[model samples]
Target chain A: MTIDASMRDALLGAVPSLRAFAISLSGNVDRADDLVQETLVRALSHIDSFQPGTNLNAWLFTILRNLFHSEYRKRRREVEDADGVYAARLSTQPEQGARLDLEDFKTALARLPPDQREVLLLVGASGFSYEEAAEICQCAVGTIKSRVNRARTRLAQLLAVESVDDLGPDDQTRAALQATG
Target chain B: MAQKRAREVAEDVVPGHVPPAPPRLDRNAQARLGEQLRAMYDDLLQQPIPDRFIDLLKDLDDIEKGKSTGKGTTG
Candidate 1:
């Protein structure tokens, strides 16, 4: 669709965060990125519907989530919903230094139930609040809260972390900041 | 009695209580965790964006300006 300069800027600006959200949702870099591009297209076409003062990130995230769910529905019968399958296979061959640890975390994260992982990434890693996450997930606030809590618990358990507070400025943190910032 | 017992279970599982001092994630641990999270995200963020998407946007911008003619790619 025909887009304005401001709209273009906003879409471009939203790209990294959108891509990161897509990746976190899909767990495959290529798929995540394609989702981002699709989100951009959809957002651009429907830009007029976007309220100017409202949150652009939330809007973009909602679009990405809808796209993901639709894609999931389309592919559910054909493909396994195996989370982080790509990362797991990659790490098996061997990796060095922090790369190995990062892969370990990815695999653990991938193994998390999609609902839990989605809530964790949306709230914990992506910095969306409970309400915003609820909106994105189309669930009750209580549900979102429980999911986040549960996801954090699961991630901690998987990683052998004693607590969610144990999350630190590791490679994942840097990547998130780099993508979002 | 059941309600009270459920509440008690919930309290025990609250994130900070299980690990102790979760709010104050130790600096070193925070650093490492952040590193892992970032690494995973980096792969996604660094993936090459298609040229067509940008070109599509540019064309749209031109069309919006009434300078370009014909339909632009929608999908």
Candidate 2:
């Protein structure tokens, strides 16, 4: 079906966030771009199936996620670099401390199981509610919550975070930790 | 009262009656992790999207129009 102008515009707007999700999911930019391109093509082709005025982002995310599970997951496992190669290749900003911490976090995130990682990105980083994430993942809301909880716990373990107090003197970090804790 | 007291004592003597405390994550550590995750996500978002994607979208649009106009169809 032909994509209308407004739908096309909306799809364009979702690209950046979609790319971010793809990157986090795939851990490789080139692969992520391919996934984004695939998602777009599929989205455009199936535009008619999309119910108008609903949550387009969620719908798009579901499509991308299904594609990841069906195709990308197996291919990614075969060539997955366990040594932080792709993450190291990422461009870093001038703020060395924050950049280093972000790198560490990304490494930790990569270590998580795909299921946990997807939930973490959806509910934690992507700002989707439990219900929304559950819908996207095709699981129960409780499952999403548990996955997020496990993802956080595993990330903390992987990062060797002994205690919240040991996270240094960043108050915002402290507050965020407390909320999660 | 004597029988109730005996049952209470038996319950106390049962093995594995008390549960262990849940492991306490350092709040600061969790917050730091959360903050770092947010930063990473934000950084990912800031990365420039490749031009190929935009070009692909345009191509798809053209293809759709082409189909409607009875031009050579491209999938």
Docking class of 2: incorrect
Best by TM-score: 2
Compute the TM-score of each model's chain A versus the native chain A and list the values: 0.81, 0.81
- Residues A61-176 of candidate 2: C-alpha lDDT, one tens digit per residue: 99999998888557667876566654454443344764676767787888887788998888777777788888999876656655676677889888887664444666665544
**Error in Å for residue A45 of model 2:** 0.8
- Model 2 alpha-carbon miss at residue A83, Å: 7.1
lDDT of 1 by residue, B22-64 (tens): 2443344444555566566666567665675677677777777
Considering only chain B, what TM-score does candidate 1 achieve? 0.46
lDDT winner: 2
TM per candidate: 0.70, 0.74
Q: Give the residue spans of candidate 2 off by over 4 A.
A: A76-98, A164-181, B1-26, B62-75
Question: After aligning candidate 2 to the native by TM-score, how far in Å is the CA of A74 from where it should be?
Answer: 3.5
Tell me the spans in candidate 1 whose CA falls farther than 4 Å from its real position: A82-94, A163-181, B1-35, B46-50, B67-75
For candidate 2, the TM-score of chain A alone relative to the native chain A: 0.81
Q: Over the stretch B8-65, how does candidate 2's per-residue lDDT look in tens digits? A: 3444355554322235456666676777777888887887767887787778678767
